[model samples]
Target: MNTPSNRPAKGKNRAKLDPVYDLETRERALALVSHGRSLNSVSKQTGISRAAIRQWQVRIEPISRTSKCSRPDDLATYSYLLGLYLGDGCLSRHPRGGYVLRIACADAWPGLITACRDAILRVRPANSVYLVPKQGCVMVTGHSRHWPCLFPQHGPGKKHERHIALEPWQQQIVDAHPWELIRGLIHSDGCRITNWTTRMVNGERKRYEYPRYFFTNASDDIVRLYTDTLDSLGVEWRTARQSRRAQNVSVARRASVALMDAHVGPKY
Candidate 1:
């Protein structure tokens, strides 16, 4: 006698279960929902399906939620963090499991390190943020499984060697919070400086000072993104060759410098 195969019969399909989420992720999503976050918002932030979230809402009782981690309601924070990430951050796979987001902050600016840590917590409150010291900088790092969901730009190879483009959702956020993004970019890779020149005025040599902002990056795509955002904000900028490959975006116009001063002052 021939034995029957265990596989599904031809022309008939077997039902498949949805991918299971770990208890931590499940609780985090449910907590967001309990706190009046819409299924859609939580879904986008956590990369969890709305249908699954709804089911959990029905089956589980609401629990007191901690700041452990949830998607940030303030898109400004996310935009700023995005700028920092695009400027000097990297996402790598964790040895234990999940992904780690790390942004290098100069040791000279202790405040920026704190800000970086806070941004990570705000974006994913559940994840733990830590500081790793390097030769001249500190790495503000956070570990979470949902990092890729928030930052789809993560991939293999160096950022400058590859193409970098924002997703539609990220574009929307950047549009709404352009200054925050600029502030972040400046904080990471841009600087405010003063240039001085001697001019003849009233038969005497007078020193004239010009304050400007310069954003330097190696990736053409990133440079374009910075200039495009500046254009939209009415901030005039010009590109100059910082090196054979690196380009420097200069905001030298008086009005543009003033605007940058008001919104994105020198990093502390």
Candidate 2:
């Protein structure tokens, strides 16, 4: 924005022409801001956004190597973003330092990111996490929840019809197996896949999946269901990579085949 002329009425003193704020306030605020104070910090201290302070061209230069990370609101927002970064489904321990979690459900997200950070930090310390801007080449699965927080109170829709299926650790699972998936026993009715509407912040893409299969069964994703329904009747019939044989079955088959190929069968 164009700076309004500091010259008040023609006769006004040049010093008086300055903005009404205390003479030193703007300078100090700008100094701190240029020195790497976060917007939240500058706003709290000077009652002005870092944006406002940066408006003056003189303050545009970087002043410090480390930007301030402490602010009441920032702690929450950063923590949330940080948590989102650590959560599975987006990025993995790729070739580079790490990966970036695409902004999923922005509806509540980014907001939930703030809340999630606390949730994550409660479980893991902040320093343990390293934040980088898109530093990995690992593949990532799309996210599940409506953006923001996943708390039941912040459920996807007001009706609360469906629960978010994306687990926070799915990315790790994907990384663990690379391109395989393991399951207890997929006894589906020969049909697998779900057509649920994905709640993506960006609406340009969609993938309809059913009969979820992964390259690795010993994954954290598998653990999700395993932990949720661990108790089993001793008579239960199942096949796992670990199982040497299935009763009355010929040769043991590997579920390592790609999901699409599984339905298509070995022949064309």
Candidate 3:
């Protein structure tokens, strides 16, 4: 009888062979390639072919090199970056690998944006900085895996909504470069301005003006850190009237204003 043999027909096996990969696998594989891994290496790790990895990279915008983890040695600059991150910075996972650090600075203060860019570059020399404009603010972004290591407070919610605390090592850095840290915090969410009010004295109406520094944030933890840092510097700060959106820490006392001016000047 013409029964089937143990082996299939010559072309039958080839016809039955289907694609071994799915969309998610292809994306992940391509992402690995984008993170500076060679096609051969990714193929070995994922069982994907080198040709397919190359095709995926060509199809999409290529991911840059994998970010190296390098702790910043510049104490001043590192502390400043930390404070900035605590105020208005965020870290997001890169599709391919590593992470992206973004800090929002107002358009009115272009120099702050430059400072953020410079600070990031100081730590991660291999990555490029990007300034993306949104309405009234500019987002300064750079890619690196070291950012989270530097700022462990990075997490899933707004700074005020989360439990933000400084590690002992981070606290030591801030203690050494308190001014830089304050500068970053003020640049992000605080401002120095002239506050004016009308008062009646001796049956006469008078207008009085005072220079004060105001730090507004939703996170009580961050505000506490701010006050604590100020205390360390022997500069007094008090909790001002609270609003629905944010809480205020005011440095309106004459001596305090002068002290802050010495450390954190206006965002010019």
Q: Write down the worst ten-residue block by lDDT for model 3.
A: 61-70
lDDT (tens digit, per residue) of candidate 3 on 86-194: 8899998776555789999999998888899999888677778998999999999998656788888988977777899998988889899998989999999899999
For TM-score, candidate 1 versus 2, the one ahead is: 1
- My TM-score estimates for the predictions, one after another, are 0.74, 0.21, 0.74
Best by lDDT: 1
* lDDT, residue 149, model 1: 77
Q: Considering summed lDDT, which 10 consecutive residues are worst modelled in model 2?
A: 182-191
**Global CA lDDT computed for model 1:** 0.85
Q: What would the TM-score be for candidate 2 when compared with the true structure?
A: 0.21
Cα error, candidate 1, residue 210 (Å): 1.7
Runs with alpha carbons beyond 4 Å of true place in candidate 1: 1-71
